[model samples]
Target: MNLKSSVGLLFFLFTALAKAQTDTTRIKSYADQVMVRMNLDTNIDQFIFTEGPEDKQLETILMTNNKTRLSFSVDYRIISATLSITPRFLPGNNDNELKGTSSYTDFRFRFFPKKFIQTVYYKNIQGFYLENMKDLFPDWKEGKDPYFQFPNLRVQSYGGSTAYVMKKDFSLKSIYTQGEWQKESRGSWVPIMDYDLSIFRNLIDGQKSKETQYSFGGSMGYFYNWVLGSKKRVNIAPNISLGAGGMFSSSWDILDDGSKANRENTEYFIFKFSAGLHIGYNTDRFLFGGKFNVNANVYNETENQSVQNNNIFGLLYIGYRFPPPKVVERNYDKVQKKIPIL
Candidate 1:
């Protein structure tokens, strides 16, 4: 080839290379700006880039300039080259199941309507679920106890509950519990269920009540259901929690002679008070949780230890947490430098 022609070709090639480098730098600069605008300056876990006609967008660098999409979608995946952009948004939530680990701050509101999956005590476990089971009574109408007739008693129970998140963690939640015991004298076998369904609200702001808190010498909030922790391993993923609260309660004594104890006329005052302390380990399917709850009442009128009544209830339960999942962690590492693309 002629020397002149060769020189011209080389010049053309150099010009094209320089132009490409400039374009690449501009695109990268734009992506960095987009990240700054979105307040997501940190290194991303993984970003999916998209634009269309899909192929029309070049993979110039790690930086992408789709700032317009920062607010509308997650990341994009360009499947074509027509510039027909598909703004992919964050994960979709069907029912209450959310994708991936929600931010710590968002953990509270993200897992709402925490489904109630009660794992009844061993005695209450008639089958797979309480929902479907033959009426143990088969004919309780003719008898007294709904599940049975004569006098069957239920003793020993276990279970505790909490809000189950997508990553298999628990949060502020209402507990659950059941207790009953009976002895059959003659008639039939029956199940006894005695428990209170109540919400106790207390506040300790100068010994007063407020919207979300309560105070006194000490403060108390509304809660029921006590499930203590277990010293054993029962499932693949292990979860444990400790809960406590104080509130007013009553004492009831049931006599086999079909006679009730001296019932006290209730007044609008703190008649009795109690505390609940629980520790539990729950699995996605069965939560073998246990708890120890104590209720004591020192007669207000007279401070007499003998006159006061103190009772403790310990139970174990096997239930399920909603959106049951294996616990996971989303670790965030600060990005000081960009990783080179291989």
Candidate 2:
């Protein structure tokens, strides 16, 4: 099926199963409160390509210049949304001179209903530079030589994941969004299915090429929340997951006459691995936390060639929870009555 059809199907399935359920003895829900948060994070989008014989192997690393991102988020009832942007003024994001100018923007929305968590997101990234310039050119100097850059390369992805928690007491929301607080320590096995459609564009020597990729995968993950402190306000959680999937890719070259040529199609198997740790301090009104995560996707391009997309990032956030304003509550109630699922 196409991207839109696939996404719509997922939405319908999740909505059919939507219900408000939680174990109050082990988890505390903030569905009645409006939570606002600010987050600072670092995002890395790097692609590594390897080719050639074992003795004379070569590798190329392409990476975006903007590494730091700022985000604002709001959570109320069953919905949570966040918007993130890479600002050049942030520390470690101002190396455009050496790495090339890049831009990144992301928007994410999530829903929590019973034991199911559904998420949808969109990402836009542009510009990339060769990060291993020294390895490629032995005599290249960091400050003296400019790295090779791809100014006309852009990538956009529309993606979503559907997940279910197997244990009723485990609070995945506490670890993911701090929308809830787990009063007791607990763990759960979560099964997740993910799907995405991505578009890549590049221009070289007055020629433009575009590629579209459709991917889907399933994974099993284990998450644990270790609540500590006298007031159960501290939590330390770690999680890991492994999965395998496949991608269908189609590419075409745009000719000067505005027609397409050199059409190609390929299919590949993909392996995915991810791990993360979260530490947070939570209170009735305030919450603060930090998380570190790493994700890698590896796929073979040819008999002797491979590609890896590796992303490693860290995030810190602070949030406050408060009662919703009267107008906001009234409007949300009216909408919830009509939708029922909310």
Candidate 3:
């Protein structure tokens, strides 16, 4: 071939090689992501990455630092079947309220706290709203004006709320703000008439006084109690606690997003994990309890990468009771038999 044709052929070959290299690079990157997703950990160095007949890379669609849509349950059958208890703590830092150790041991009965078999879709701002269905306002009466259509906005959030309960069974409650609580309510920040319940408490072992016990509960929560060792009067058994739930949006966002970008529908997930101390005191009518809760949680918002965490305090509260578990008492002297004729 002539020099011109040879040069042209070489150029074509080089271009093909470059394109193939680029494709290979992209594939590797994608594979690395996949592996991370499968492992559910950002630290991918734990796995060996290579290319072979039996090896291929992956793309990670989900990353889990704290919340990555995972659930864990413990069935420590032998000592206890199921129990629900929570912790109470108070944050000393001026800027935060729940900033230290927290715990919620038992709250598996309320909300029909069954086996936690339901998958509740909750978050702040948009707790539970219809999405797949068409939005339609109620029809007007004869002389009434035509009602407008429902707004197309979604504001799903998940954050713990503090409230004051005066009556039992949440007959009346006042909801507090979420993060970095403000001391003053501003008077206009009318608190909600009621809240589901508060799971944090302070175990006041001082004077005989009623240490305000907030009903320890989680919207999407459950409990599985298990006793792993021999039961004793001063029994100290290790345990685990997990609670997860989401919050709802308000009507304000509904109106705003209704007439705007219509891109405001998203959900947030909050999960709490507590592992610390569990002390149960047996009584006939009630059970005195104590828990020094240390908890860590992850807050996740849809379509966002900046997932946050908080070390919630005031999550450990005492004074929870249950049916008096039967205790067997034995005397060692009655069974001691030794030969005296030595």
Q: Which predicted model would earn the best lDDT?
A: 2
Q: Number of the top candidate by TM-score?
A: 2
- Could you give candidate 2's per-residue lDDT for residues 90-191 as a string of tens digits? 898877787789999999999998899999999999999999999999999988888999989999999999999999788899998998999877777899
After superposition, candidate 1 runs with Cα above 4 Å error: 1-170, 174-219, 222-272, 301-306, 320-342
Q: For residues 149-171, could you state the per-residue lDDT of candidate 3 as single tens digits?
A: 11221222222333222222211
Q: Across residues 2-46, which tens digit of lDDT does each residue of candidate 1 receive?
A: 323533443443333323221110000111111100111111111
Off by over 4 Å in 3: 1-231, 241-262, 266-276, 294-305, 309-342
Candidate 1 vs candidate 2, TM-score winner: 2
Q: For every model shown, what is its TM-score relative to the native structure?
A: 0.21, 0.91, 0.25
Question: What lDDT does model 1 reach?
Answer: 0.23
What clash count goes with each model?
38, 0, 33
The Cα error of candidate 2 at residue 112, in Å, is 0.7
Instruction: Score each candidate by Cα lDDT.
Output: 0.23, 0.87, 0.23
